[model samples]
Target: MTPSRPATAPGVREPAGTVTGPVGRLSPTDRFLPLWIVAAMVLGLLLGRAVPGLDEVLSAIEVGGISVPIALGLLIMMYPVLAKVRYDRLGTVAGDRRLLVSSLVLNWLIGPAVMFALAWLLLPDLPEYRTGLIIVGLARCIAMVIIWNDLARGDREAAAVLVALNSLFQVVAFGLLGWFYLEVLPGLLGLERAGADFSTGRIVLNVLVFLGVPLLAGYLTRRTGEKARGRDWYETRFLPRVGPLALYGLLFTIVLLFALQGGKITSQPADVARIAVPLLAYFALMWAGSYALGRAVGLPYDRTATLAFTAAGNNFELAIAVAIGTFGVTSGQALAGVVGPLIEVPVLVALVYVSLWLRRRMTTEGSGRGG
Candidate 1:
């Protein structure tokens, strides 16, 4: 049976032989515009430059004195992340000893150690910017992983499991890693004395709003929608219905963030430039690590991409929250965290293409050997 197509923008058609399934696949536009994440970021820069007073306006416009802008942005970015999972995926993943062990080792054990080293080595001159990289790095494997993994046509089940595991790990590990790397080590390195409030309250609220609330909302929406109108119906009917809403929400958030950072980009061009090497290195190194481990363990190409992408991506959502609270909005540390999406979007898009190439090469070599 031919799958129903979502109405295309003018002059677009389904690719020849394209067949979407019950689990709706990504569209070509979704696949291509990851690079536009960078564009959205630049647009944000322009907003910040042109408005100059946008931040104050955002801050002043608050609900119960809490910043509405930050709150809305967090919700928009996080909801689709949680919505992607089925709880059964989590259970199945737990039983798969290999996936669990690999994820724990990559996310909890190795990722932070290397990130710390790279940040310091690369940005010795600027202590604050260096600390920001560590903050972003340590809070690894968040929403961006899901985006990248989905784009690479990863094993979504494995990706879901990995994301849940990493989110849990981040709560415990983020604080400890922040203290050790940001506070203690930085002191030892002669940067300033590092400090963290470790406001459990704030962290809990962030988890709730960013991770927990959206997760529950996504799950409930899925479950309720499915019950009301069977899985296939919901997949074919509703998800496609709301997909654009989620996509546009994300795009809008990116534009706002970039605009807020607009004025800073020119003045802080060096900041982005300085950390580019380590950020680039981190991406390359993590991709290699995940791929090598995936191959060594004999995972299939799709699963390997999932593993590699999950391990390589950073969870900038929590990182931004922590940075904003720990360092005030204008602080360099916060700026570093803010600059993350600006850098991450473009890099990940390129990485997606690279991952596809790697999969093809590996598959070809395997076939040749078998022949």
Candidate 2:
């Protein structure tokens, strides 16, 4: 759940909350995001089960291996979130060499490895689901991380820069990493390779269409919006109106996804439950490990929180798009992608409080030591 206000350090409070707070302090829409997502899933399942020929109607038209309706949902879901990133602030974020190098190592390298290990370890029998989880790990986070950082009083500039960097790197790295993890690395480790074979070109096209196009559109929207109207208007007046669309888009996509695979999901409730275990473990391991790393490097609370959240969050939208685009819409991979947010939302919300509590404890202990 992202804040209505842009993710900047603010000293003044509005009449109600805007950019900062713990889980309870979030906006109503954002606060109940998990509810909305759950409701969407239920609705889609009902529609698919009740209505005959609905899936066929929805899939009648296709473009670039994605159904037209689903493709539109993906683009809408991604655009506003990507637009929220401050591409201009990379220099400011990069000046902190420790933060930059640490983020790259965590996001690019460690994040994927841990996810791959957990997915394989947990879901050795479920290749499609395992691949879906691995794709989730590669996505990195450019979306709701701003809200998570702000809630924990993290370095907004660092979140903005890291998110921005992720948006760009995703276009190039997503394909190569997918190839390595799904095919090469698995064979090297004597693990089962992915059941589905994906060509490099297909993965590249999926990324370009889902991430690249929206990234460019987001960059241009921010640049033009600020240049034409001042930053104040862009952030305050324009962004709030546009930001909600991302949620709408996300819900829309989920509905269509479940509609296509409703029977399969309803039949295998145990499968979804099985998927949740590794995801919970993944968040716990990533956050605890990254938070500890931040301290080991001698960073203070704000930068440390940013580092932890960035490492823990994943772009499920891109994962879903990749799964559906590469595999069929009804593939097991898409179902696993759908389950990502369900596990991630509540876990991350709890971790926000953990970060705040840790911050207070650190402050009090530091004061006592000084005295």
Candidate 3:
């Protein structure tokens, strides 16, 4: 079972240590992911430019039109996030109707609408990439929000429930939402429809492959490991070992992506920055909107932080998987999804600090009122 707080064992306090490198030094990857991602991007671009045949070789290593390297990377990226979810705690949120309803509204309704509007407003000339941005907007986060919530001192139980709910909800709602937002809505709005295969079957297949496999793997890993090795060992030892695989896979995927799309990326260097504009705007807007909404609704600081992070984050893994499955691995659409994480990690980390600062301010204000 998942602990109500940061996973700690009785008589064994959780370490307050920063992530250290192999040489016992502070690792840049732990403290600064964007730097590492930029490095990977440069390396990938160099490799692609140096050896033009490499992209072809990787593109050819596909099973049923899906790139094998990307698929494996997606699996690695997703499983650890899923495995950490405490599915058993999902039921506890039944009593907190305000948090549940408010979060769902923020995630499903307002979030997608803002993304669609921003993508259209920002990238009218870049339809394929705009569709990719829309896809990113549609997929509510199930992974990284947990980390953000923890950093912000959010309500852990509420975060767990929301995460589990979002995971199951994504599996069901993502395909239909993708079709509607990326396909039908754009058509209605007089925008050029995405020229990718948003077929229901393809969408479902991607979900099953990307989400289903990892979710099951995560559940099994958690349950079996806990039962065999005991919960304390599983939480402290097993999880710490496995958690970094997701980040490693993410870096690997970024390198492969930049390698394949190096030419396009180089030719239209400005476009990468353009793609990030709406995404950056969306994160800032969503976090502020959700935080204010939570406070207006009388939620305490912890739950408000939970609401804010959940609303702001996106499940870029699912977005990337669908983009690759629908539009080929090297397509502009897939590149948009790739850019999602590059912008997201740094922005969210900054927001975590902001959330902590807000928490302190709120506490101070409340104390003044009492005095």
Candidate 4:
């Protein structure tokens, strides 16, 4: 295991990670996530196109207005991520007020606005798709981002705090933000409004189902595991065993989504590209903007990387759930949400490399300035 760093102190220049030595190397699974996701996409599309009956069977298993297969996949994907969060460290992050406030503002305010603008600019004619993109933007990330931040050797404690903060905020803000951006704002912009229903009850329920259950499970698991096996054993043994389950669940979920929506994707290949434009742009723009802002504010490299990633990543699970719940299983909105992870996994992995390069460059510059 890579040695864990101490919790960040306010305005302190702690070592982010080894600058000259090999940092944390990727596990085989981490190295191939994008490839696995692509394979799952291909298999799902093939299953949907060839075995059309499968969709009906999976779609038939509904519970609480959510598809059973989807619900299970989501639970599996989310639980491991939440389980890893160090909720106890949230209070420690408060001392670094700059990092905390900057991350929150970028994620909730600037990130959503940028996505909304890009969706309108890129897909003016496709309201459902636009609304789907907006949903992606509003639901800030809490899960996979930990993997990205870890890969980049960022401030793990800060990442944990931000993830916990974002998860709680999404439960309260996502529905209202969805209504405001997808419905009211579009109407005010004189654009065709999305027809999907944005019910606060449904949104809250989905949050409870998707995030709340997993969070509680994670908390319980941590408490029990630590009590029985000690913190080091739990972190090294128990977490390692369970952490990759989330990725497995994510790949499985992708396959199901693609299988269900294969017909639409095949029929309208151009639409996939169209939906992708705003999403790709959103990731690039938000990452660049957040990185620059963090540098301008004189944050250290690790915190800056954390802020950039936290702002750039989206909780696609929540977005997909809301899209499917609001629209139907095969709605264009849901398709947009499904495409989010497909796009995100590859894009973020690449950005992990970019962040490392940035970190090295920034550190060298700082050294030169001191000299």
Candidate 5:
């Protein structure tokens, strides 16, 4: 009589052979992602505008033309996530054709198409905002996919693999997608007036400053951490320690972004209401599409939840940066970028509970195994 292999951890669900654990531990204080973001945004906006010459200061912080605050925020947000990934397991995923193919198809092909349709259906008249939405969609989830995947007790290994692969695709496809949707396709739609000046040189600089540098730093840090702390210590000790710092960085970034845009939001309160519907619809639709696709592929409930969230979540940080850099902060493109987090945080929290409910139902349906 084998003592029933300890129940899968609260957040982890695997096939019959594996052990599970709590996907994530959340306290009452930890539950306020969106609220915190909103607060930071409000404060940041006020500071940026009221302080006078703050933009110059921020611009001065640039390294090789990358805004320091944004770069720091992105690095802090991303490193913990990269640290969690087991680079050793990367090869296994590369070998698994099914996981590789599915993630690629979902992230690049189907996902962008869905976003385009939703943006068009929701804001056909607001071409700039629509284009901004397209940029956000093109970016895809990078850092936060780990959080969502963990929350759903997903196949962590699979998630790690998918994230690494998606990151690659995003760097390549994002610019191309932005060009197609924001530049080329708008002309075809007879919305040439909506075009924002896009700079290939600037985009490349951002990729290097925001993306390339941080990734290298994270990789080096992870390697050093593994060597010094060992695998278990790195996972348990280091990741947990860095998590709060990452959150703080996110909060700071939100504040700065809102500070920059506070007056605009205050002046045009109604724009929030207008954009809210489409953004909400976009989230719901993307999740539904991912869930349906996972089911069709016969993935287990946890994997299904991870896939759904990963597909639905947008990399608004990168999107917002690109929008502002390319189109200026006052442009409709910038407004759309700001609107993303306003919708995303609360919506993602709600989806967390939804996934939990779905998990229970799936377990029951499958007679204690995930369906």
Candidate 6:
């Protein structure tokens, strides 16, 4: 059974991929997301430009190759959303072979290939930016897919299952896939690979610290919370309080990232514009293709929404961490990774409206199941 949607909280800004209310009742954070993102980007750039030597201070402190402040922001951004996941509900989703298999193919196989192709086609000459986009593709949606699913009234249980699966897979497959896409596939295609000498051990370690620690904490928190006070309290009462932290963490991270690289971004507007092209195509194609696939297979709208969203969204947090850890903080790769969410947040938010409209049309046509 799916977890019940949280009751609407007045003025409470749910995290990007975590909590959402019905469409008409979207929080200010949700509705004006593009504005907020643009604001965050602007603020960050301003901070860097205004304060001399600030970027140096921000980058000076580091833990595990990432700036300490940026790393903390990433952790804060991820934990609340991961905590909200109903990890126990995965069993319910596992039995749905069609949905599971479909998600697997869409997320792991076709999704990466599509991004790889787009990055090469659009930014063939810009290797650093291109590699960043490739990292974005390899990192599938463990975040924000749920928010899209919830907003679209998708299958919550399936969404949770898919997210959990992505999380687990990332710990293992991320390094391997990095090896393949960054090195092996390029060699086979006679394409010059990314110039950085990526150490797999380092990637894995970063994944463990960035994703693994938070995941374990989220799981333990849920378990302890439920056992002590039960699921209802854990979901409704506790979640609302901690959930807002996700946005705080996300915005904080963005600010720090921009503060460090603001000068580069402002100076090279054309390069940033170049990076945006492939990401725009990636999101649109993945969402549309997966949605069409779902309908072709005769799945209901809810699960189809889940599949489409899960397939379309990338884990920008992880991508950014990997980029920063592998490349330096100010590298073009990290900047490309940062640009990912700037595009994804607004695009997927718009898609939620599209999904709702399509749902209405399907109902009017009597194509809805059990209608």
TM-scores, all candidates, are: 0.79, 0.94, 0.91, 0.89, 0.83, 0.90
lDDT, candidate 4, 48-135, per-residue tens: 8788698668767888777888888888988887777776777888998889889989988899999999988998888789878988
- Write model 1 residue lDDT over 291-335, tens digit each, in one string: 899878878888888888888888776666566555545556666
Which has the higher TM-score value, candidate number 4 or candidate number 6?
A: 6
Residue by residue across 272-309, what tens digits does model 3's lDDT show? 99999999999999999999999999999999999999
Clashing pairs in 3: none
Q: Give each model's clash number.
A: 5, 0, 0, 0, 14, 1
Off by over 4 Å in 1: 1-35, 62-66, 142-147, 150-153, 168-173, 184-205, 244-251, 258-260
Better of 4 and 5 by lDDT: 4
Better of 4 and 6 by lDDT: 6
Model 4 CA deviation exceeding 4 Å by range: 1-24, 196-198
Model 5 TM-score, 2 decimals: 0.83
RMSD of each: 5.4, 2.9, 4.3, 5.0, 6.1, 4.6
Write the number of the candidate with greater lDDT, choosing between 2 and 4. Answer: 2
lDDT for each residue of candidate 5 in 1-371, tens digit (9 for 90 to 100): 00112334556566785423322243322445667777777787778678867667777877654467766776676556555556566677676565566677778877777777788887887777887787777877776666666665676677776766666566667767666766677678775534445665565555555555555666677789889888778776777777676667666666666666677778878876777777888888888888888878877776777678778888776776676666655557767876787788667767767788878887787785553
The digit string of per-residue lDDT tens for model 2 on 1-371 reads 35654434467554564434575567778889889999999999988888868767767798777789899998999999988888888788767888889999999999999999999999989888898899888889888888888888898888898999988989999999999998899899888887556666787899999999999998899999999997888888888898898989999999988887898898889999988888999999999999999999988899999999999999999999898899878888888888999889899999998999999999999999999
Best-fitting candidate, scored by TM-score: 2
Clashes of 3: 0
Overall lDDT per candidate, in order of appearance: 0.68, 0.88, 0.84, 0.81, 0.68, 0.84
What would the C-alpha RMSD of candidate 6 be, to one decimal place? 4.6
Instruction: Estimate, for each residue in 1-371, the C-alpha lDDT of model 6 and write its tens digit.
Output: 11234545668776677635354445556556567767888998888878869756866797666778888888897798789878887778777888989998998889989999999999999999999999999999986787788888898888989999898888888888888888899999999888766676777787888789888999999999999999999987998788778778878877877888887888888998999899989999999999999998888999999999999999998888888888877888888988888888778878888888888888878855556
